[model samples]
Target: MSEGNKNTNTEPWGGFDDNLIQRGGSAVIDMENMDDTSGSSFEDVGEMHQRMKDEEEVTAEAAATEEEGGEDGEFLGMKGIKGQLGRQVADEVWRAGKRQASKAFNLYANIDILRPYFDVEPIQVRNRLIESLIPVRMINFPQKVAGELYGPMMLVFTLVAILLHGMKTSGTVIREGTLMGTAIGTCFGYWLGVSSFIYFLAYLCNAQITMLQMLSLLGYGLFSHCVVLFVTYSVHFHSLFYLLWLVFGGLSTLRMVAVLISRTVGQTPRLILCGTLAALHMLFLLYLHFAYHKIVEGILDTLEGPNVPPIQRVARDLPNAITVLNATGKALAAGADAILTQ
Candidate 1:
């Protein structure tokens, strides 16, 4: 018999043939180069399978290590996506910071409101504060610029409220904490109420607006009201002035959401949102004005005896029935009399 035929007949089906294995596989593997620990006994098919599994695991780990270093990745004709994605994120942040700083100082000059501006630069903060007073910046940059401006800007308006409050209680003897607390509370509470309503509407529309942003812009709205108050301190603000600023504040808030979700929110939903926010703003302002007397009186009554009158409370509560007619009449007269006597 021929050698090949003799071997084929003599060898059993399960017997090892390194030549058969080498020929059947798609790739060549040098078994001689395999480590000594991997059993060299190829006679047993089960032992050969275990050795082959160990080699596969070792090769896979080595490939993975090289892939992490980007060598194997390139060898497979693929670029490192992780590095590219990281660079994209870093570039976006850098550009956003620059854009925020630029727009903060030059709002009218720039018309874009696509970017959400946060992380205001120190030098840009003062400029941003001034820009926020203008309707465009207040509405457009509520998230990035106006949000940070809330703190110091509200502090200024709160002080104005405090001063007007002191003017109201010229003759009254009350706890300083009570007076300060009322002014601070009224100032902050007003923002809280207004922002809460706006936040609810924005969330309903699936907008990306946040409570902090809403509060900050509401604080800016407070600045407008406080300016009106400061200008009319002697006579108190007219209802028309209140109405105008109310319209102003509401439109600004609605515009802010419009800018944020211009593509997502529909016109019908936008109108509904506007109507809801307008109602909220009107009610919030009405509550502040009409309820001021009762609120102050209650605080005074809470702090003192029930006998304490609202006029004898802080100046913030001097408005009788929330009307501008008799509102601040006593406080204004007191100021005039004190000036005339001096």
Candidate 2:
């Protein structure tokens, strides 16, 4: 009882004290390992930031180099050989356009170039006029004599004036504005359009003639129209008008054909060209004759009074059956009005 009792009192807590001491030592070692891991993680983060900064500097240097190289070497957002080629093509197009514009300006703005074509002698004009009137006379005439623009321009203007005067004198119910416009348009349109057509044909036929030459010849040809207009308006005879128109029209056609044929070489070509020209001239003349005659007939009807019988009007050789009906209708209307008033 003495030895066992003494041992129990000395070691009352025994293994529990040993377990507490060992746990405390293990916790301290775990805390030191955590501190070391945290320090290493911080160092890795700093290294990553430095690597990003270096990459950013490299990218900035590349961008600066491209900008400096592009300043003197780019065109329209293109680069290198392609850009240089584009610039050259653009320059060539610009130069070509500039040259064309300059040529057009010189052609239109300079009046002196046209002066030579208009400087014609009165005797020359008279001779050309005579030749245009008589187809036979133009046979031996010099081709150079038909190169004046003044005579043609004057003749066209004169024809217009004469036509207007005839319309006024006829007392026809035509608007002056409309009549003047029509006369000017018909005369000038025929002159320009036909002359251009003939010139094109001549070119096709290999005839060495200029545009101004064709214009001059066609312009002078208007003298026949002036003569026909003057005589028909003065006489007021339907038969006389037709006679003059046929004769003068044939003469003009023959004259034009002769001149055109002289420019050509081959017999078959000349014949074909002359035939075509004759047909064209005759058709043009016929159109003009019909137009003027219609006006003249209107004037005659106005002067003769509304009571003139339809049969008598028909006997006046009205060109259109519709014109006869119009006259008959007008006469009937007048009679009906008279009967109503009475």
By TM-score, the best candidate is 2
TM-score versus the correct structure, for each prediction: 0.40, 0.56
* Per-candidate local distance difference test: 0.47, 0.62
Clashes in each model (backbone N, CA, C under 3 Å)? Answer: 2, 0
Candidate 1, residue 269: the lDDT equals 64
lDDT (Cα, tens digit) per residue for candidate 2, span 162-192: 8777656643344445888877897889889
lDDT per residue (tens digit) for residues 1-342 in model 1: 123222332322211222222233222232322333245455667645654554344344434554566542332212223223333444466568768988887985553452334355666655644544554433333235255543445445664574445446332234455655666666666567667876787788766667777666556545444543444333444565466555654554554444444423566765666566556545654444433333343343333533333443434443332333334344444434544675
Would you give me the overall lDDT of model 2?
A: 0.62
**TM-score of model 2 vs. true structure:** 0.56
Clashing pairs in 1: 117-144, 168-315
Which residue runs of candidate 1 sit more than 4 Å off their true CA positions?
1-130, 136-146, 149-177, 236-264, 282-342
Using lDDT as the measure, which candidate wins?
A: 2
